[model samples]
Target: MTTPAWENVSDAFMRNDKPYGGGAFRIRDSEVMTLKVTGPDTPFKPASEWKNPEIAEHTEPWMNNSGERLSRSTASFIRGTLDSGMTRYFQQQAQDGAWWYSKDWAAQYISTGWMDFTRQEPVNGLAPQITRLWRSIDGGRTWTQLKWPEDRNISYLKFLDPQRGYAIGWGPNVWRTADGGQTWQAIALPPMATDYRKPRKQFDAVDLGPDGLLRVAYYVGMLGEVRLSSVVYRLPWDKAQFEPDVVLPDQVVVRLGSTEEPPGHTYSIYALSRLGPQQTDGDQNDNGKRTGAISMWPGHRNPAVRQLQTFDERYSLTDMDVGKRGVLLVYAGDSSRRGAPHQITLYSQDYGKSWKDIDDGMTQGGWFDSLTNTQYALYAYTLRKRQF
Candidate 1:
């Protein structure tokens, strides 16, 4: 059987699920769209209850940012989600094999198309994709291609406001755009020292801090290599040269967040010690295919290991976000089990010391992969349930 046009979606992530105002954002057939939700009604029905939602026609074909072919790109169309009600953006693939942001509800939006990474080829007999930056102030209803300076691939992109933002690629340097990416300037990064081997930095997280600093995290290991530890660097708000490094123990830091309350500041970090495919033959949940131990570090303190059953092969941590409300955790369960794809959102009001399952009477269906929240509202992106 063929998947219908309405169902041929890569993701249907809920932007919000509140009673009065909530909806979802979806990427289907290379088009970015939304499901308008309006209600003060609590405890809505399953995701299946809603169908044939409206879609925005502004979109492009799915492709990797690399100088690949016009075919399907290995990159996920929508990588990250951020919505502050005023500023909404989606991190996705750029033209020349890098990730860029598409401000969904912004007055000025930007996107890039396919281009040759190397100048050896005449960019489909034209200019390279690196030289062009597409922009649209009218929320992507239209676009205008512009020019750029750097040709580097952005591994991490974070926007503190509509204008102030930071981006970093494979290199150790960081870039800033205070005028909504209209112009970019390179910033110096602290030198990373490797014990013996050359550092292969894999950008993991980049976030804006309360003290007007940019907190960046990366592991010094190549892809698929065993990572010993990770490093967190703090970039000052001003263009001053100060590198504050926080090196972790012998574990790969999968997630990093920080919260500034009153007396002092605390950094919430999630590190994984072990991970592998669980053996599943008879019982899917009983296997250890995705077995791994996740530990948390709440700034300058000993790590707290959450010795829970769900953290075993049956459940895998998918996403983590921290805000004024607290830290939110989204976990994906083994889809083999019945009713296992329901929303699994956990909250840790007291940092990562303890967490509470807060998915009571919420939207149901599929694994919640990415989650972001405002001071009062929380939004999540989920993959639809798999059919047998």
Candidate 2:
């Protein structure tokens, strides 16, 4: 059905209930557009409960720049309860950076979406970007911004489960949670070999292995350039520290996030080997693409740190993770030298041994619900809950 002419679509997503249970989405006019699963006709419901709540002052960028610099631009966040049949906005601009909000599908009583608000504080004329993690439990009705340590430089955030997650980074890496992110505690990382020359013990990725060990991958580099050795730490899920579980060397680790269906039950990562350069043959062909081989770690049955083929394509990877039966869902941008603008979603049931092009020219973001085999893709201003 065409979008209502009276108001514009504020955001779109599936109801997250049983697949094909046509539901509603928010529009700009404080109304809900109730969509039918099988029909084109949808009715609108007035959402009068949604109102702008009181918030802190503005100083950050509605576009860019830090707070102390104090530019004229402003910023805010979208907050409102989804089940309440409405939408509302929150006022929040701080000393620096940017905020980007996106929508996701809802299945149970709670729906969720993640937004990263970056606070770029310039030091000696250099602005180092600090992205603060946030999650909305009530379907984007409200967002809880997680605390990020200033001392920790690089972090890879993952949710093993909604309430249990981990944030691993360089500056004394690892902040964990067992309460669905309500509170996060710092977890000490296991010590590494002493490299006085400022060796980069930068944590690259973390995943729960099928062997019941938590595998943590980090780059052992000299001043940030990777050396020829590979190391993946391991620890029991119940344990809070690490011990070496080193894996194969020479490949760069490009970590993908977890699945949306189970939230964090399935974790995946890509070990990329630099092929140096490439010239693609597609319309969104790439030039000088850095990837040659793409190996994925899938399933709870595979040996820990074991890499499997997910895709042979040299396209630029945007995101990837495992779904039901270890099926791989891959999102890619143009294979171009710079990549992106042209996006595609691919799925493979038997790892990457086989594949399906779900959307070749997929624009905007998509959250794949494996349980329903539905792709909740946000296009333009409308949410298209279409099936693959």
Candidate 3:
């Protein structure tokens, strides 16, 4: 109920132009709102140009099937031009930094969790919070909040091709959302003791395999207590659910790739993990920077974690994306170093095993925010401030 402390934050995603026409989504206000760019002629506009863009309001309350009142926030999670030329977007009511969807935006999903810290004593030794899920059909112009049971607080949602998808979070429970976010069915997972005090096993990322199956990746205490352990749960698209859980050593996995091109949508999944030692206590890099590394799974079965030695060490790799155009990695080299651009980007055709430079020659101060891929083109969003 408290107003979130606001700072000027904005970002944009570009859809590659066919040598002529392209589009972009300018995200602003912690992703609560966006300014859209329809393309070929639309150049990159600075945040100053859009300090205050046009705004609109909706009249109806966002509602779910169970008749619960789901209010819509002015914010949005993502926006872009779909391959069909339909401008679409999705967002949640609560302010949390996570999202799930298809690359095409045919099906979209998002969730929210409310924290209650007023209790003198923590429930189950952890602050109590409730989560909800929501969906949008017409590019976020309107929303349909889905009905979930009182005990459920869903955390993450990911969809493959708009029809096949999965959700995992608070229950650490695995859910299937095949009807394009309208409803979900629970698929039982290995039972871990639920403690309100201890940290919850969070589901961080999910990817589709090349064989057209689903693979989910999650971590336990990897970023918190310094005990690094993660698991990749694989499920087929057709069966109600069967678990093929692949567990890995202590490392935080973020971006996952497939043996075939276009990443996230294929099988034989390969993933990127933070390398070197992570701090044993606390969060947010009090320990130090983790050199980047890549891990691969040849298939949903018995995949090994190996160091990708070919990745260049010159730049501190920070972010990554994979698509038909290959892989894109963001580098934020140390400004303290004698001669390095404040930030730059690199690309890889053969996955993360090797990388090549793709800098736009901006040497002042620019940081990569997000990389998006559509069927025909790839887009990158970055933030830059004048050195002067």
Candidate 4:
């Protein structure tokens, strides 16, 4: 807890020789001392002590998440533009410049596929060339860097076995390696409907499940009144084998993930669907949960997807990630039940089959999220992995 500021008591000094005893003097313990000296602005502005990005410096500052022009460079998709707020974690980012900060400055960029290969939280980043590649032989306890294929803007990659691996990105294309990480062969996908003007694809990413099912997520931008949704595609690793299947008939696919059922778990691949534009938070209702409903496809090649969850338009799907037997989701709102600004982290313990919030303790026990950030004291429940 922050100690309050010291109070001046000329009378206490005059009352007795003991400033803190007979005079009844003590520290005020005011939190004002720790509070930021912020200027009165609707959208919070940098303090006088901070370097105002509006005023250029010798160094070309990064485009702050906030509308300001200076400060550290950040992705375009975060919520609040500063020390604490960021875009949803785990959601696939298709655009090159799109990125998010879950709990730090480490921005995770996306490739062209349905998700990041290392959906692991707090991983360094998916930024191209950050490391050639990260491989974990001991079931992820420790990882070793290997030479990633030099030129592909790979968004998703997973090894089916010791020697065979597949990656998709750089467009609606993919790369495959038969001899582990030594080399990659470019595989071009058949031409997609990119010839139109309305609802052109802005972001694209791919996802592959443990069942060898391939899925692609597309955020098609609305160019005219002719809005389109059925953007997700069931791709063919070998086009000669099968044809691509359009998953959602009318809604846009914003998030895609797959988690194998662990023992008694009913988990499988899932997708979050949005009925409207999927670009920014503005697309969501006032409550933060996006307008789209979350749908799930149960195990063993379940072609039928059932509605898993939906909000009353008050909330939107801000961020998400899949787990071994659970799923992690984050939702933000213009205001909370008490009508204060808030964000909620949702988790599904039994994979995408179910969701509920338990005392994750990270946000439950209110803590300073940053040097100037304080987490919300709300969210009676939040979904998160009980174990790592």
Candidate 2 per-residue lDDT, tens place, 81-174, comes to 3345323333232232222222342211121121233354445443433344556555445566666544344344544445665655544366
Report how far off residue 228 is in candidate 3 (Å). 6.8
Q: After superposition, how far is residue 199 of candidate 4 from its true place, in Å?
A: 15
Tens digits of per-residue lDDT, candidate 3, 1-388, equal 1111212222333333221212223322223223222211223345455535653322322222111221222234435343223244543343242345454444455566654333354546665556666766654566777786635666556566565677766646777876776677888653232335535655556665656666766665543333556666667777665564565666666666554445455345566666543355666665455555666556745666555533444556554555543443434454335653544555555555665554444332223223333211222333332110
By lDDT: ranked, best first: 3, 2, 1, 4
- True lDDT of residue 261, candidate 4: 42
For candidate 1, lDDT tens digit of each residue in 1-388?
Answer: 2211112232333444332222234332233333222211223334454443443221222222233332222111122333322122332233323323333545433333334443455534445333234444655445555456545545556666556776665445577888877788877665442222323344556655545567666555432232445556667667655474465434344566555444356545454333432232577465344554445445443334342223545555555555444444444444345663554445554445555553322343322212223212222343332110
Report, for all candidates in order, the number of backbone clashes: 11, 10, 11, 20
Instruction: Sort by TM-score, best first.
Output: 3, 2, 1, 4
User: What TM-score against the true fold does each predicted structure earn?
Assistant: 0.50, 0.54, 0.57, 0.47
Q: For this target, which candidate reaches the highest TM-score against the unseen true structure? A: 3
lDDT (Cα, tens digit) per residue for candidate 4, span 346-385: 5554544555532222232122121222222312222111
- Model-by-model lDDT, in order? 0.44, 0.45, 0.49, 0.40
Q: Which sections of candidate 3 miss by over 4 Å?
A: 1-74, 77-92, 97-106, 114-127, 161-163, 190-199, 210-212, 218-231, 239-250, 259-268, 276-279, 282-286, 300-306, 310-318, 325-344, 357-388
Which candidate, 1 or 4, would have the higher lDDT against the true structure? Answer: 1
